[model samples]
Target: MHRDFAFIQTAPDRVFIGWGPFEQSPMRKPGRPAFYIADFFLDDPHPWRHPAEWEELTFDALADRAGDAPAPKIEWERMTLADFQPIFDSARAAMRRGDFNKIVPVQFENGHLVERTDLWPWLFRRLAQLPSGMSAYGYSYQNHGLAGATPEMLFASDGRGYRTMALAGTRPADRASELLRDPKELREHRMVVDDIIRRLAPFGNIEVETIRILELPGIAHLATPIRFEEIGIERMSFVEMVRRLHPTAALGMSPRTEAGERWLREADRGVKRRTHGAPFGLEVADHRALALVAIRNVQWHGDAIRVGAGAGLLPESQLEREFDELREKREQVKALLGLRASVAIEA
Candidate 1:
């Protein structure tokens, strides 16, 4: 029998709210969702939970549903550039220490504690606008919401095989050619690809498609799609694939590699992952799953609207360029929300 599902996650295993007559078992046999909307956390739980709470509802399509909801009530938070400098410095130090090959540094921005019922329709419509190669999602209940338009696909599998993208090396589209040639950007992009390939080894012979330039509205990335020829599905569960691939080098270097292990253990102490790089997955059909990274998402944590952005830093990275890259990321969200009081840190 089919069921319903919806959720907005912060990190770890807490939900803003959820309702489910889960059409498919989210952990194992979950089939396609009935208007399925779920979010995953970077803090993946080893032993999974059903997370089903209430019965499903008849969700309306965006065009018909958004008849004329009022504008969102936005309240800006207090923060600035001086506050984010330390994070960059620390990440740089770790790279120099040989403890990290790359570190994604994040900065928290001013909140836009929205008080409105229109957030759901707004977020959904905004998400729908993203073009090919991107996935958008939002979950709102009790009048608060969490949403993102993410370019990186964590993993997607149709009963036939498994595939994912190695997306890294960000630059504005105007610099696309420069990015493709730059040794530093190429090096960083390779690291992300290698991490994905290394982790997928157990699955099968990996066929890596030619790396291409992925152009987004504000930035472009070097993206490579990797397909596994054979998967040891009998011995693995869908979530198990998530466990093996997460904390990816695009965000956190994988601990399984010698260098990545040290980075995970010895790199910048006390700074938890800001975005957490959550892996939100869906069963498009029975046994077919598609998961995306929730990196570009914004959150409303009761008291504040939290937006964050990061750039992968390598020992060879330029602080000024890295800083500029992160600013672009943060600003994209700000512009998307039409918030006037955007905040920034120096490059």
Candidate 2:
């Protein structure tokens, strides 16, 4: 029987791969490693799974072994401003009502695979080619799964302490430097940084690094690295820490309180977010864990595929520019999936 498979880039050159006829549990088993996969809302209580087999290898070795198989062709129905305008309007109204200083609304491009294609080769090839600072990750179970190269780390730990980042504020890669002076982008970034600091403050002494630009294929984001040290952060359960910070202002609402949850419930658009912008993580040793924010990825169920991209909506956000930002992000995701290439597997 074919089992579920997942992989995460553990270092610049290293990747961890896991095969699962998994044992599910509400939390990580003592002295054992597990993968943590959850939806955007962190809805699953039993999100931890112990895989039957796992291994770590340098990405070059994986790429050398991944045969050259053509990627699938996809017929995508791109999203338009009209499709997302209503969600933007709803978020704006909530902001005006003081429900949130900022919120992220997502748009998706739905597609259909044109042929029967094996995704493993395409996925590993892309992983091997990822630029520095980006992590390649994927999880597939049966006919449904998601995969992407993401620059945002939700959090990472190794027993003694933890490290995370404030990743928000985006611009086209060409205008990356403008992020330093763009008032709206700067404001959005500060909200993410401040909110993360607030959440992690209770667990340890915090150190924040100067903000920098994280440039990817077609877009860039302002990112600030943060560390929590010497306050016994190990005492706090990993999942509890995830709960406290999963949807930091970067991908959720600002202020890190109950209000954000309430607003999310009220503005529910009935679209399932699946694993987009959720926490996808792994732990191979006790007290050592790594979690990546599941973004810049393509998700599929059977022959249907969806690419989702989200934009931060501030009171000052304009519909036209936000719409364009969504397009930029979607394009980056396509590039990562090799969907932007001219080659395809014939139906």
Candidate 3:
């Protein structure tokens, strides 16, 4: 009698499930934080599907659901990059015209794997090496499955109030110091910080802590943490708290101005992002909530599987270098999946 469920793991021992037929967010139990997944797409005006539409069983339930047939063997096959050069070109033009201070351009590199083992056991082994900020996750319904690791924490509801961070400006960890004086990276990071402040100002009192560098296995980003107090129950539900801050300048441009909107529309090139940079959260028994940006993650839709990646585009961004960054990001994910594909990134 168990329905389908979504399971997420931040660490090897920490796993939680989202039992489904995911109804509504704001209307859920009062004082309790709702847990779900969110999606942001180019054409879809409102494309956030929290907890996904799949409802099934998990853990002991999945084993019970598994029939006598042996599961298919999973192997990562051919790699291909989403056509994003044109979008990058346009974003750079926008930056030059002062239309947008900073724009983040995203790309998807897709490949599929046929699982030879049970979902949970295989996933545990695959995600065993996640770096400090990355998280391992998997969601399946019927014949489809989505799984990967992401390092961005979009927002979390601390016991006292709400907390989120501005993560931008990617660079190799060895050369992270160069980011300090790099105008482009600093400008991009500032845009994220300023936008977070503007959106949270209306909620209540706000506080911002020191800005530092967040180091990852292969890359690093400028990070700043912000908190808001007295959110006032009336303004709290998912609509007020999440919708307002979604598509951050780090992921999408800000001010919701015509130029910024146009940049996203034209730059996106009609790609539908399933969970990359989307929001995912966990519900705490204590009534507190935790949410993280779904970047560096992949999803399964029917038969397709892909890992999502994006880079900030400023007027000074070099096209080839940005492309390289995307390749490096995608390669990092593939390596984690234990796939050694002979994929080469081109200019």
Candidate 4:
């Protein structure tokens, strides 16, 4: 019997799925790389189950379970820092101009290869091999593939209630364990938590925890989890909450729309790469849509890899520190791709 295979494509209605070849990175020959399906999404009955389920199915186990599944086609391309610097600079300048606090800039490359059928399962197997501290999410859009292990909560809703957290501010530490002791970093994180609570006030009774330390693979982040209980309104769906909470101050400045526009305009003019304008894949449902901030992500196209990294810029933000932050974020992508050094930036 012929096996079934599908490629995630965006429709006119704005529905799409994006997967990177993360799991397959280590297996690919040097110079001829492959993209693991990092993210997968579909409207209504999501095509793939929760990421937890995917995690439980390992690569060897999956091969045994579905030996008949078809292979997926791969595409590849390279992204350079020379191409990204102007976009970063523009976002920084926009912050200086007070357009908004920060806006994430992203880029993608098309991987030009195709492998076995049954793409998601194969992709999931690869991701499952990663360390547990990594948070994996599946979205219903073809936005792009993200790799950064961020501690910020973009938006999450559990059918009845909705909650989101802001995670901004940064300090470099030689060890991830030191994040808990950094008072200055904690202060920056607090600013985000305080603002998110204020924004969710109209929805219902909201409770925010005090700042605490959260750790990912190579970094530690100041985290504050906020919870909300639905009040007068009927049970709120995930899409509804995302509409209100997405592009939060963590990704853009307060009054996000204005900040986004300024960064978009500047990035469009300064950067030679493509900017999809808005987040790519947006799935709306009566229940929920887990929207992830497309940060520290990269796109695979044939032999080339395009890595996206940006930092929050405040009036007090230093260019050198911001540069360091970008470097830290790029480290994983470099390691995954087996690249020794990252492309340097003039900024």
Please tell me which predicted candidate would have the highest lDDT against the true structure: 2
Worst 10 residues of 2 by lDDT: 338-347
Residue 225, candidate 2: alpha-carbon lDDT: 96
Best by TM-score: 2
* lDDT tens per residue, model 4, 1-347: 12222121122112122233222221222332121222211112222222111122333443355443333333333444565566567666766777765455544433332442223443434333444424333322232322232234455555567556666655443465565665545555665666677667887888787766555544556667788777876866434554466455555455455556556545545433332211222232333334444454444333333555546555565556566676666555444333333333332
109-165 per-residue lDDT for model 1 (tens digits): 655544533455555445444556566655544544567767887777745677788
Backbone clash pairs for candidate 2 read: none
lDDT of each: 0.60, 0.83, 0.65, 0.45
Q: Candidate 3: where is the Cα deviation over 4 Å?
A: 1-3, 9-13, 19-34, 41-82, 114-120, 231-235, 284-286, 341-347
TM-score per model over all chains: 0.78, 0.94, 0.79, 0.61
Q: Write the per-residue lDDT of candidate 3 for residues 157-258, one digit (tens) a residue.
A: 765578888888888778888778888888888989899889888768889999898887677778898887755664354445667788788888854578
Off by over 4 Å in 2: 64-66, 257-259, 266-268, 342-347
lDDT of 3 at 345: 34
lDDT (10s digit) by residue, model 2, range 48-88: 87888998998778777766778777888756678788888
C-alpha lDDT of residue 86 in model 3: 78
In candidate 2, position 329 carries an lDDT of 90
For model 1, state the Cα shift of residue 65 in Å: 2.4
